[model samples]
Target: MSTQQSNRVTAVYRTTTLLAYQGNPLIEALPPLNSFIEDLSALRGSLKCTPEEIHLNGVERAHSICRVIDDFFQPLSQHIQLHERISLMIRGGYVGRNPDTGDWARHIQNGYERVLSGDLKAIKFTEVNSTAQSMTLIGCSGNGKTTAMKQLLSLYPQVIYHPNMNLEQVVYLKIDCSHDGSLKEICQNFFRAMDRALETSNYEKQYSMRKRLSIETLLAAMAQVANAHALGVLIIDEIQHLSRSRSGGSEKMLNFFVTLVNTIGLPVILVGTPRARKIFEADMRSARRGSGLGALFWDPMDEGREWKALTDKLWSLQWLQKRDEVLSGEIRALWYDLSQGVLDIVVKLFVLCQLRAIATKVERITPKLMKQVYEDELRPVHPMLAALRSDDPEEIIKFSDLKLSDTDKRLLELQQRVALSTQQTPEEFAYQQLRTDEERRVYMALKDDFNSKLLAPIIRQIFDQNPSLTWIRLLPLVHEYLNNPELSKPKDNPKKPKSTGRKASVKQTEWHTLDSDDLRFIYSQTDSNSEIYPAISKSGLVLNIQSLLEEAS
Candidate 1:
């Protein structure tokens, strides 16, 4: 939570229905628990758009469609259940440590005394069995674990300031686990999260910025701040990033989480990819701690009622010119095949396909268009989708975090550029065609003055003629062809047989049946419907233009 988030929530104090949650200002400050219907109403991330909006200019419609990324959450049953569980966790954690009863003050004093004595494990306060419990959510990447949690946490005011008690009750604090997974770093992050949640620098400045502090001292200090503020529930995301080598092995980190729940009375929620499951399974005690509230393992959705329900809701938010009032079964089936029921991919694929529809003037999503968008625009997640498609356990296990590779990231950006540009250049459409950085570098250099339509083929001509030529040597030959277009004309070569009359006269659309070297054949093979520039460069085809230009330059 930042200052901006805190401003959105008014500190309206309210009474509670449950006995355990009553009288504690920490629990009382929270909104009352509502019926399932109310929870569903509060959790939806719906977007608003009209059929008339599709008549706007391409760029405007594209900008409107992009809103789906931030504002198109449809609350599923799992989301509502998660919300209810977290609600219980927060209120349950506060039950044993009501501030008015001095139980909370005693916990804070005990933590300080432990720090002062330099013995974090010492028992300085009267033991009151904690109602605090910990839970874990393990799932595949992009299954909406983090997004769902953020939306659920938003239902509570993060920081509630009680002027009379002069305390800032942090309703919840969420932090990312460091890549190193060091518990000391986690404690430092705790202080940093507290600073952001309360808009104060005291804890972070005093504890986190200190250089000579021992890990035990940091833990004691961190526990004190959490107790002092009555911090409700602590969510640690990316728990899969925890490295055993750096964090003194998985057992130490698990023990620390256990201590937070069992001793410090702070409920903990660990969210991570499936890789984190092995960390918790290191020992039974750790596994028990992880399942205090029953751990949730979210597999990718199957093509069932839940999938159809979500897709139907998402289908209604289209900004396409030729909007289909109902989703056709063929397109729906194709969508599932492409996305494989991963929530993030499902939404993003829809968004990208609509952008493609508007950009190409197709103005409607077809099974063919959706498939092309997935193939051309979504190369980054090919491996992940392949693993899911295989249904093989070993292949799926290899991907803990199915993040995009660097090259595929560039491809996605190119797609967005092509989709949004009203005056889209040939290079924007052709760039995705160039497979290698070397090919793209040459195309980009000459694309400013020469048409990519003309430049890409000539570059391919040079590369095909001189396969061993470096981009350095390739640049000059491309420059010569840009100046003299006729130099690229086909000429007889001793290496090739003459084309048959039938082969030479093949119709353009049916030219894919011709030799692989034919430009018409290459153009017929592309996944994108935009232009033939990409396909021309993709096949190493060119006329005698490179040979004549090479000699002239």
Candidate 2:
């Protein structure tokens, strides 16, 4: 038999032996979930601006807020699902196996020989069966699809060297579909990406620079390079750019993707805004092929659990002078109305409102203030937001992809204005003077000394009571209160306790001694018509300790 035929026989023999020896031959090859999560968990981004940072002037504050915006990410249910889906795709796609054709053994054997020979063109293989899958993620702009994917993919090492196989495996490759949408350009892009990843300009020089090369020739080169590197997945972002009028058409572009999966056995993930939906809808075969892992259509967040969770977390990051930490119903309602639950709008509106609050010295984010910000600062996005608010699918689609160019420009202007104005504000200058390092140290120390929840309001009250006193001068009074806790407590007439028949206020104690009935009564008082007992019972609240202990038995 020839070398290729001989290798095929060897592969079959090894496969049979492995199957007989082990119940599951591919079990050891699967990527470990624990390791993936451990690696991924570290990749999550976070931003927290302290009180001092919040107190900074406009330009500084704007810069800091922008950083927060850039760093902020709240992983939702869809994020978890997307991560798992991609992981599954990678695991299935990179298993180097196809039970239908029994090609796994041949692939492994050929790959080893190719590595040993150190000849890129020596390996000869046929595409009989492919186990590659494709996934399409369609979402509105700024829904965090790209950001989440970047973070998720960052967990995996870009280039993994399998010492035993002597192979360099690229776990994933991401490329943006150019505006031209030319197949030739895409093929060149693929080569350039590979060149960057491998630290070699061979492909770029060999394929891309050659103007005479046919699209087909470039595509063949791309397939060879992809298989040579053992590419795990190919992610094409901004797929909407593949306009039929500009490129050979969406059909041709999609055909290329199908070819990749069917022949090269490389999984693909296409990510784009809602505009790309037209491309997939144009060809049923392409749509069906792309839905191998199922299509994930991410709409704007509804006023549901995910929306509440996202807003609640973002609300907690407030650094305003008048901190409305509680997410009031009115504020939430106004927020949803203004943003229509689009995450990008929600975050931008929040940052702009904070800036407005600081600029106007209102120092709080109220319903009126939020509305004013949305009307004045976010006028550029008003049309898009209105379309979303209309709940008309066609209207939404028309406006969904609208870029926020004007609004962004306006925000920059606002930042500059705030920075300039902050310097001239006498109160800000006075506040800045009082904010010495020692004063901050004392404030932080006292914050730790007292209940963190109570300290801010107490300090605000102290400042308000003695407006003339500088922060440094006020430090002694704060220390005195801390040193003598009894002096800080409100004095009550000694005879009043004897005169009143009722017990001290329930708020006085921290609920350590409150009975279940008393807690239920308090809960009922908070919402008079609501059934507290049933809710408490559903929550597994037990009135009696001995009864609960007996139930555990």
Candidate 3:
């Protein structure tokens, strides 16, 4: 019973701590912060259990409350950081687990948003409808900003969302702002997003709207459709793209965004990285007057007393789930030593350690397992971690300025190398077996050292054979002959290995389609909308009769 009570007091400490660090900076492991956590662990370690002593207050209860007073209240009495810690935690103190839903972390963030709404329904009391509203979801990289917004979008779409009551005339659209700089490109992507939404909405009554719509007709049609269906929310994601500017282009895009809210009266929700706060502040200068777009401060966990608070919250969260889960004060001390209580590091360490424990069939999370996960899973993050570890103001800005999201950017070039390595030739396997990523990098560099004698014969042979056709196809034929064919046996022109295996006879039809400059999209290089149109639209009775009259003429 004494042991259980000790655990409860420890639980309270963590619950209190994590609540403090939620939207704060990544805390450090220096003096007071580390000492505070250590002192609490020491207090728990020193607690003595007694079955006797006719005292009114339980011994365990006294120890628990004293630990809080000594480790928290007393130490915090002289520090301003501690005061800030208490304030933020108190702000979110009411956001407990929902009785029915029981989702804790998400519910609290939801509660934070609800505070603005001034109602239990979690809709802002202000003009949630009939007004231009935007939210700056501010966070640096690895803070789960994008993932949180995606989750919010998913959750909000499923809920009973509205301004006052009218739900019939509502439409919702979500678009990533990185689509392009031009207003036309942004509008074009808007239509594309709307087109997908219409396909998903799948309302049969809107069939005519869908049928009459081409991609180009999407924006004007959506504005009309919103009036008809009542478009309520428009979510513009990745507003940091405005920082990714081209002269006055971002201003133009911002103007179009303003036009959507001001002219169309559609409620806009802008989600962006920390840099987007600059764009919003800039916009509030001239044209964007009276815009009620508030910023949601999603700061990362800060250091000092806040770190201990964050660690405690994260620990208690687990304790609530499994009282018998082996992590005591000893484990929490070890965890804070390695991870610094940055939520990403803390969360990822858990995931990796869970996998590690399960792989080794261990019953509990181990400090050794934590070390291994840190080396393997968390070491790659050391560069960014080192940057965060610095105290320079410039370093802070550099860390905050996520030029491209390191987490979201595709490692496709590496993947393509792996894919190519999977399909290696016998010559490649014999000569080159790249054992590491760096080894492979070196191998690619030395590839240009090849003699022309290796290639000259191949080119000579290709030109010797299919003079009428392109060398692109002929080179592959030559490669096939050399790799898999028999030169001595006249093996049915084994140069054409695919043809040698099987032959099919079929008539070929010449294909022709006229294309304008706008009909192309080369991904990274091109921005113009596709100008191509198919010949299958309704001229109805008028277009047919006009065609007939033209024929009569």
Candidate 4:
């Protein structure tokens, strides 16, 4: 069948036999391509397992590949100009489904009988009511309300098939809610929002004159800019900032939102903290008429089997490969506990671990290494977590308003590691559990004398004596050295140049290695100045590699 003919048949089936067509196609036009597309989406949806669960099943590569294919399709190439084609959905309209969530979970601004919201299933308004409806995304931080809103901004199944775009489409504008709080600041933000949309649309030069203007009249001129780019959704993130302490900020901003949407007939997306509900409630009348508010609250994920599942998904990311070797289960679980299933924390934890693994030339990710990361890299995370755990809502509010200092940020990461690691037994605790001659000696030094430094050297001496022992065999030695701070301590993450003209100090740790390659790569980085340490063969090795690493970092 011709593409046009097939679409007509499918559209008729979709409208008349919606159920029969749903979950299944209106028409299975072909077998091979059709089934490949079908099965791929099924895997994606069921595979909605968290990073941890996916890691346990070893499926990160599959997920990434699917994402890449979806992103590059028509939605991307024609993003800036899709609004011009806006018209009524005629015969044979294509309704795409989310591969990850399948038909039931497919994204739709106008919820329908078959489509529903996750956990927030309140209403399913018709498509006719949705032509360009304004939406309000409400929720608390970390509850995933904001993240879901951002994710929903994109198309379901990632790609929209055979998208037809006119020369004039949408310009998406985002105004950060937590930014400078004032009526003037709001206008400035609108200007910046326009510039950002221009940048995204690759229409920078054409809008340069508007970008340079700082005149007061420029505020009212934002409408022209929106019309120029065919503005789409104007997302205002962190809307609760208005209530944070700006005089009449809410009223003025709400009025501006009203002007932008009601005056121009454009859709706006409002994202804010749970506290934002107070603002919306105060002006519920205006908000209702302005944009139907949909609250999305974000909080730390619930603790449950999903925790394990999320942890497993992260374990198998391609970056976890040791010398390009796949990551093992023991290492994966260690990473999970240290990261506590937080996406941001998990990614950083892994990156820190990977950089260390590369520098050390460790052949694999091990629980002990993750502990080293906790001490060296993640130690900084403690203070932020302290703030989060603080009982004072006022302090949380204050702290949330402030950016983290270098030391405080690092401490917060440490706290996250501690929280996540609660899922796994610490090395010290496990060692204490096992009683042997070596364990007893290390324990007594730490508990009785607190001679950790003295004990570490002794443990190091043992490893030096039997250097050929495998990591499994060297477990006793590792236990002793880990306890002995003097001989074996946590390694520091590489840092910037110091002004004092001090020589770079690379702290060496007597670590447990399960294999020979692991030990060799580690020792290779160290200097052989009677001290086994990583050596810099700067002249022979690639210096440009460090530049690339710096750029990427």
Candidate 5:
């Protein structure tokens, strides 16, 4: 049958069928677990900063350290499992028979119709059936579940286009559950996310704006859109918002999730705090249907190997004047006690302590200093940290409800000031003075070779001697001075080359392997140095060739 005719038949069958169509098994599309683990293990992110980059003064160092939080992600075992589960869900959800080469739609329609007619006994054994998989991520506040999910999802493209199949596949869509927990609002969020992903406002414009639309109609429309776009996975963040009292009660919301999985064949991942446990417990069958890949409960890092590893890695990123090479027993114990092994609290505590250390000019981190900072700078989170230390679940939840607005605001202000300060040119700073563009350029070129303090005086001396020299003419002179400081001063007896034998014979074999400095010396003897040096340097053959020649020789 033609593609157009097949789609029409399938649509008609879908309307009459009671049972949803399950696509072909997705096992073939999924990589082996080992391969998946390897791919996930290879994922890493860190702020790119060298020692030179971190050589900022006190205030600059504090701000730079704060900025590291933006990219700091330490992978753990939960991260590996999260990657594997999500990868499977995405691969499985996208696995339908090839639209270009197979009559898969016909098979789906037949199976769906037969199952709907209550004639499962009559259905053939040859039919393929598969459903979407799901996983739940439950964690306490600031346990890094949300951050981990985002990092892993970032590895896949948001949209994939298959030209042969004429399909635009959405790899993943993350929607924040509405604070009110209404299914209608969740549907609208889905439409908005779709519009954002596809860069088309059609869905939101058409369906989301229709206030009269019922939850069932909205869900049906969402499923249709999901299938049409071949959505791989749907992530609902802040799922704890779907409380029974807030989101039309638990039963309705639970059924909605079931429908999403069974009807649309779209994998759904629910990420929320411990409060979400009540929702799952309210409906065990619905929870089972939603979580095919099992749930990951992320708690605070224990004071074990993982905690030590994380703290040790983060400890190395300190920008203090006095490097804490060895994490002292007192400091380590105090750190775990103060932060309670919570990743977010641990990092913030570290940052705040660094700032305090700098402001006080103590120039080093210590147990006593950390305690003082905790009491002074981290007052907002003290209760939560205390509750965690107490090991009281109810008290912990209650205290954790507090947000670090004051601390975060201070950090942001510091970051902004640092950003503005760093934006100024080296000449703008009070400590360094460059009187002219020529001086600045020459200093910059040789800054890597010599200390800025040492190089500045030399640059000033060269410019003072030749006030009329252009930058281009001054560059060669600067290079000469760098090669020999005595060349900058007056040379009474400049050595001239002695013609050993009228001239040395040029050998083709030796010429090819000669260093640029040697080549320049030979070219100058032959009166071609000026012509050759610029071309050789511009072509990048002169800069790094000396090491190779030295090694070969």
Candidate 6:
């Protein structure tokens, strides 16, 4: 369940250029700091789709290509700043806690004393002042805060093995604040995360599994584990959830996070939505500690060079039969209007438009189709998008971060069902019918080319629509329908029976939703935004190259 993977690398310590970073095994084992351009190039996502792959004649393949966009990250200025800040924080924190010296051992001893005494202040026994600092990154839900963090973290090994000292140097560990924002849950997750990184059940068994352990005892244990492993940095995401913390639980968590930096010599990065700003603002001491490395507020992307660069790159991945060689200004403006510059919405909008274009046989993205997709599929976020558009402080405050909750997923499902109901084709009407032998023969022949379940409806509809046509003549039409499903759109059926139940009265069209296998659904289920594509890929949503080749053969 842990999102981060450990790269158990042998310690390859280099002489660091910076004086403060020099002579520390923890700092020296890291990949050497690079220039801005080098970092940018390294951080940019490498996943790409070719034109041949895009134009592949299969709905499933098309969906897989669309899902690929989830992995398409282009580092911007904000990412560079974050990279530098985190890079500095981790190495700087390690400067004072050299494992070669007695400093690290002493720190561990102090932490064990704290754990034994059930006192957070017991770590103050050491004369070595922590060089560690904490940072806060606040952004809108879909603006790529967690994504950037994860990508940057990928530069360093999550777990490093030092054979000389028999140390498992955990470079970093990230955990989410629980939905209820319980400090106890956070402590348990920390232990679990550390256990995962270190490949040991000792920490989890010793601390987290004990139900009767006081929060103070748990905090002491958590801090001790962090020091015992020489944890480089700690990242706590969804800090906005701390708003749900009851009876000053939020304050206690904040104070403990500060102690991790000040006492344990571990840098901390707190990532959250705009709503979390109020928590920091309430306490001056916590505010100062939280922003020791300067807090970053990530607004939704604007229509600037970064936006153009991202869209231009994304626009090039069209799998439509009629690929638009160039992105036009009209469609670009419409995209911004609909997504309001949220990175997730922006990418999903592009993806859904392509899927819709393939379904409707438009073959190219247009402003009208984009708008229609937005209206039909993305209605759940309309209010949030509207709030962003208004740019009014009061209006924005009324909405929560646009994380797709269970309710939102239900809304997407209902919306999709309604869309399917209203847009029912002739194929749908004749789907179950296979009354004649000729229809059965046609089904047997085409089932090999297409999915059996999907081909049934197309074959049935062809026979019903052209009753006089032979099975020989119907083959071309069936293939055509497979390519363009909208070719046989049904006319209004006034004679059709109407629903009498309460379900009929329910306004289903207003309920917006997405499907279970949709990338958005994968995103919702995932813990880290950075891991969305990996999760989707593992879900069998992305097209497999070997399978494609085998099918072609």
Q: Candidate 6 on 1-553: residue-level lDDT in tens? A: 1122337788888887788777788888877777556666666667766766764443443555455445778878878788788888888888879977778888988998898899998854558678898999988777888878888898778988888888889998999987756777888999889888777888889888889999889888888888988989999999888643462555666687788888888899989887888778877876776678888988899899988998998887777656567887867888998998998788877877776665554556766578888888788788888999999866776664767454335334543543453354434323323445677677767765776667876777776676655666666677778877776544433443343321111122211122334455446444576877887787678889998899999
lDDT of 5: 0.65
TM-score ranking, best first: 1, 6, 2, 5, 4, 3
TM-scores, all candidates, are 0.74, 0.68, 0.41, 0.45, 0.65, 0.73
Model 6 has a clash total of 5
Positional deviation of residue 147's Cα in model 2 after best superposition, in angstroms: 1.9
lDDT of 3 by residue, 1-553 (tens): 1110110010111122554333221110101223323333321323222323212122222223223212221122222322233222222221221112332234334334433443333422233222334334555565545544332232112112222322222224667766334333444456665546544444323433355544223344444443333344666676666533552544545554554454444556676655666565665553354243544555455545756655554333221111223345645776755654445565555544543332232313544456766776566565555666664545644556444233212222322333444345533642332222332333343335443234333444444344443434454454554555455221234454242322211112101111111121111112233412221121121246777889999
TM-score of 5: 0.65
Supply candidate 6's per-residue lDDT for 251. Answer: 64
**Reference-based lDDT, residue 35, model 3:** 31
Highest-lDDT candidate: 1
Q: 1 or 4: which has the higher TM-score?
A: 1
Query: What 10-residue stretch in candidate 3 is worst by lDDT?
Result: 4-13
Superposed on all Cα atoms, model 1 deviates from the true structure by an RMSD in Å of: 14.6
Better of 2 and 5 by lDDT: 2
lDDT ranking, high to low: 1, 6, 2, 5, 4, 3
Taken over the whole model, the C-alpha lDDT of each candidate is 0.76, 0.66, 0.39, 0.41, 0.65, 0.74
Off by over 4 Å in 5: 1-37, 57-63, 96-130, 399-402, 416-553
Using TM-score as the measure, name the better of candidate 1 and candidate 3: 1
Clash pairs detected, candidate 6: 411-512, 412-512, 412-513, 412-514, 413-513
**Tens-digit lDDT track of model 1 for 29-62:** 8777764567666677657777678666566777
Per-residue alpha-carbon lDDT of candidate 5 for residues 303-410, written as tens digits (9 for 90 to 100): 888888887877887786555677866688899888887777788888877776555444467665788777877788888778887889898667543556787876
- Which has the better lDDT: candidate 4, or candidate 6? 6
